[model samples]
Target: MTTPTHAHGHGHSHGHGIAPVSGRSLVTRLRSLMPLLGEHRRLIVVAYLAGVLHQLLLLTSSGIGAYVVARAAGGASLDQLTGWLIALGCLIVPLVVMSVADSTSAHVAAFRALADTRAKVFAAFERLSPGYMLERRSGDLGSAAVSDVEQIELFFAHTLSPLAVASTVPVATTVALCWFDWRLACVLVPVLLLLASVPAWLRRQAELHGHELRDSLGRMSADSTDTFQGLRELVNFGAHAQRLGLLRGQGARLAKAKSGHGRRGGIEYVATDTIALLGILAVLVLGARLVIAGDLDRSLFPVAVVLAAMAMLPVLKVTEVARELSMVASSADRITTLLDTPAPVSDLVSRAPAGPVVPHVRFDDVTFSYRGDQRPAVREVGFEIRPGETVALVGRSGAGKSTCANLLLRFWDVTAGSVSVGGHDVRDFPQEDLRRLMTLVPQDTFLFNTSLRDNIRLGRADASDDEVEAAARAAQAHEFIAALPEGYDTVAGELGALMSGGQRQRIAIARALLKDAPILVMDEAVSNLDAASEQAVGQAMEEARHGRTTLVIAHRLSTIRTADRIVVIVDGHVAETGTHEELLAAGGAYVELLASQLEGFVERAS
Candidate 1:
């Protein structure tokens, strides 16, 4: 009703229209989060240190166990055995303290950081152009806002501290092993090195499958959202099987991507387990040889083998965690890409006068196109609506009717030329300042899932109950609202209100009337109504237009018969303009359209 989705096309399916965007590095993606994470940076650092220290304590406790074994095997005194055993138990309290500190700090910082990131993402969406939101799939965007952010949480909560510990604790343990017998450290070093190499060797594969998994997941979510939102339509048309088939297609793609990602992870998991096992075996053989050759004390042989395994333990954990980073990295890529999406680039001038204002609206050779569209939706077309006049715009569907209203409201900037209000370019006013002077009643009204009273109040938040009721009465929405169970307070929206199409139109008209803006743009407001309701609401609309500049985007000729002037648009350009009788007398594009409608009417009657 506002311009069709495009000037030429009817609509697009969910998964087919996802535009390609440049991928970003994980570190580069993380830079957007620096401001949000700055608050908790200290806590994150503390968490890392706590995790490493806890791991060190565990390794130390293991070493004490090995030391007690060696002393017992050497036939040490009972007091010596008791002292070493007691040392291991003393390590317990600090271990408990460090574990609690690590888990608490990591999760607290991670959750708070995630909360901040989610808010920023929503805020970015708020600041973007309304047109941008309409162009994207709601479900795909929802996945980014909800699911993608959830994936990033894995890195901070479960993976991050472990990654830090892997980097640090293994090196500390390896140094300790070197002190025991440098030969033991030698065998563990190659195992740690090989396990660490797994991630780097498969880096390309990780990135490839990560993107696949994320993209397919978004596609499936979008398909599901589209299906659910249009479930009623699908069922009414008896197309349930068709919708199910599309959903299955989306599911199949997602499954394929998941399988690829899992296969990559499996490789990393196998490499880690294999390398660790080999290191343990090699240490056992070497330690046995050293004891037999009498080059090492028999009591220290088993201790050295245990130390060799402990040193390689952290590296094995590192590789295990690395496998999951594929998802985290991909999620980060999507989020940052969203943040980087360019908002409509423009400058709004502050020179326009403030306060309640609506002047003559003029389009001076206005040319515009939606992003990604080749040809302009409206091109080099000019028109004017003088203050306090009622003008009707009539055209075949997709003739840029609603686009004109979008321009006046500054939902988008013109590609070339200018649209002006009060003889100043529309961009001369801040978006908020410009929108305050006009109201657009779209064909499809979106009501929030809230009370009916609250929905009406959205037009003018400060309007009183009396004023609201007056507006509702003017739009003829009052009678039906009063008949409802809760009257004006009845809950309304997706599942609430149980409203008819005509009834919803009346509510929208009421909302526009409440705003009381000086300029009103109504797009087929009465199109959904039956003849009886249409006549009543038409009278209300007629009265509402008095003393205001009104632009009616009409498809039905009967609706605009009372309009003072009519402008005929053809393929985004104005073809004719005059009073209804004057246009009919001219016998131009207007007459051709009128004749076609008359022929259709006669056919329907027959």
Candidate 2:
């Protein structure tokens, strides 16, 4: 069976690295992950309870210390100190247990949420039409799947849950303080507002920086992809230095962006810290005034200070989390955009009547234009291929050869006319059902970075070892495949780079044979091969075409000579249609094209 091949020019890596810590938008971005949180509410509950218990233990230690100090200053007995110490130990044990349990549970929850998110993103990608995926960059998609997804884990594991607890604890503590001393509670309110507001301001700045950082990273990633994918071209043309200079500029731009974001972050931290210090100063001045005025006793001064200091821990923890949340927020926005992309096409089951013959593909006044493009790629195109007919399309680039092939495959719906297969409108058939009826081999082949056997079996998931080998032999790939150290089991790294272009083509042909579909479409199938490999692959193509409705996009003139019918397309219109000789005799566009290639045949024959 044939391996898949990625197209050559589609890598999208724009390389600003991931944004700095302070430049993230936590709230806006991480909201999507909340649905998954709802899905695993039980796990989240357990982790949250543990975190709350840990917070309570932390609160108790400070509260208990306040009681002990207040009593000792009032000249309480030694026995009271011993009793307080025992009480503190009780809080300590549970704090230790809850900390460990919460950490472990939080880790599991993070991984589960991330794994589910990744699976869903991949499934969404599958439902999208190949035409849609082709228009996007590989690197940007990868960043969403890998880097952006990773950013969300922090929010899921801790930040979001803690926000609720953090808010609750501070308000509760403030109320309790008022019960003890109303003046202290009143003084603390304004200070808490100032601290919260500081981070809120920082968050706004972070959101802007985060958006800029993500955009820069995308550009940097796109550049990296272009550099690596075109490495051979650069090396062959001796443009290595020139390419390196270009890459260096992209890298420098990214570094400068990152540095600017970092500087902004430092400013935010300083501003927030100054606000916190102002809070402490406000508390100290207020408590001192109350004590001197005798509105509060001198003995109560330390307890008020202790409570205020204890309250700051949760407030400060939240502020720190705020910065982290901003970063996670930026990641969330990217991931959400990817997930929200509409998949207009979806898998459908075949519902044809039992024993009914499968319908042959037909196009009736079909027209299609890509989104945002002014001109239609295929317009008023009409054609038909009966069962078992080998129809070849001959055209120059952008003459709608590939566009016709794409429409017939139902990659996009025709804008004006109907496209049908087996007497059913293409839209009526399930996407999977339509796919199952056809096997496609494009000019570009994409093989996974995986074992050759696995790539071959992708054609027919249940095919036997012998069948795979037989298909490979028919496609003229078995000899070279056998020569590899691991033979059929050899790994073809990243688009089958280990194999020659001819070998990769044969493998793709083998896969089409294994699919055993009623319809086959081969676009520029043997265009990349030398004469000998072309002859072998040509024979394999003929074998594959047997008893199937075959559509070939012929780039070379010789291949279409044996086609049952040849259709000439020029400037998005059908210029001629006939057998090879009939078209030659017509003295039209096909004849002109054939005349240009006559010299090559004469040289080969000589």
Candidate 3:
């Protein structure tokens, strides 16, 4: 596989670094979501307008209350009071209607944006190399796909509309207060500015705390997944208590981080409320003095105080969402980090070769190294398989047997030299086209958590029931599947846990058989089978080998005797290649490997 490189133009020794450019500020991180928001701009616009109207009505209530109190004290007529009350009632009804409409539209738009984001994340996962994916913990990746995406809803549904309304309502409220008295408007402006700066002052702390919280949650999730997957092993080893203690420690750390985050938020909250209350007191004091000096009308004194208090309300609303904004910033940073990670192999080829498919496969002076490995897994290796020929690659463990197969499958581009099928370089063909030309049965077969029929159908999604049954029978999996209570419809639990290893292998073989590709690669296909099942699978493989180029990565000596030729790989190079009897006579790597296997078999019998 291509080694992973840092793509964000910087490195962090401790953690995933923030995005090189856009991740520096909360506003920029939030702005990254605009494309998703743009998808539903109509809804967003309606939601924003409705939110503005809702806040306007709410702020208007305070002015109306002040007006009523002033007029009532001035001995207004009953008809005038009744008329004012009726007008307030009419305003309240629309306020409730707009409030509901705003909430509904905002939530719908938020959920839609969240869904689109999740889809994009999933597509990115597909484009990333499997080798790169293996380095990430399943839980951490899952949290990025699930939890992080969900956290963004707060930004879309709650933060966005309120931010929009807060930006406008405070100005509108100030203008109205200015109409009554510019002096009161001037007093309120500084207090609003100070309140708005609180989040900025706490920015660094909030980000640090938010990062800690998200990391803790991700680690805890990973630990939980590992524990559950290994529950049987933990119980058998009598280490369940120890595992539980570790999880408890993780929980404690998460709680402590959450506590710290909340404490910081609490301090900000108290400061904001204190500042808001003081602004109101300042306004009341200023208004009373102006009234006594006849600089302000007595009738408008209550109005000025109430409007000043109301103006600060929007600022308070903005401050209220500041905590959630910090969390959104942290989540966005992680998501951007993932999106920025470079794929191990780029899919740059756009079209398949125009010529006919070539069954002949060649690896010319191939060399490869896994990321972070000190030595190449395979080096300067050269081999070729003719069309319609069967070749067995026999080697001891770590001798680069599977690595060769993986190179042929293009799981990793060779670091040196070329792998070609049918005269076209594997890299030249689109990945989909290259994969379509070959079928592989890996050593460890993976079965999805689905019905047995569905698992087999994965090989050819449109294959009919008859075709699936035929392939299963050829793979010698039909009998067991037929015996199940649900027959082919039986559910295979997670990772095919409900079936024995051999059974899972047969199902995988059946899947390959259904594909009916021109090139077949089998890596230890019979490794898990018992003697009888091995014989059956071997017979099926022998039949399937006809008129197809086959590469078998074999450890067992008996399985390769009938091959057209045997190539013995020793220390990542081909040491010998000949027919079975010819190799035994040569008495090199192949003979030695065979002798060791025979010795083991004899010891087991004894």
Q: What C-alpha lDDT does candidate 3 achieve relative to the native structure?
A: 0.83
Compare candidates 2 and 3 on TM-score and give the better one. 3
Worst 10 residues of 3 by lDDT: 5-14
lDDT of each: 0.78, 0.75, 0.83
Model 1 C-alpha lDDT per residue in residues 307-369, reported as the tens digit of each score: 777777767776777787777777777776667666653445654566545567888998888
Native-to-model Cα distance after best TM-score fit, residue 7 in candidate 1, in Å: 7.8
Estimate the TM-score of every prediction: 0.90, 0.90, 0.91
Model 2 lDDT tens row, 1-606: 111111122233222333333332355456666886546667777777887777767777777777788778899888868988799877887989988877777777888988998887787677564744565566666676776677778887767556666666667668866866787888888877777766677566677666666666766676788778778889999998998998798788778767767877777678767777777677778888987888776656676677677676666766776665655677777666556666544434456434554748787887766565556666787788889999999887778888788777877666678878887777777777778888998787889889887788889999999999988887778888899999999999877877777777788989988888899999999888888878888888888888999899997766898789998888776777899889878899998777666766688789
- The sequence of per-residue lDDT tens digits that candidate 3 reaches over residues 270-386 is 999999999899899988988898988787889888888878776788898887687787788777677767776766679988979879999899887766565777788888999
Candidate 3 to truth, TM: 0.91
Identify the superior model by lDDT, candidate 2 or candidate 3: 3
Ranking by lDDT: 3, 1, 2
Model 1 steric clash pairs = 2-402
In candidate 1, where is summed lDDT lowest over 10 consecutive residues? 1-10
| Model 2 alpha-carbon miss at residue 9, Å | 10
* Candidate that scores best on lDDT: 3
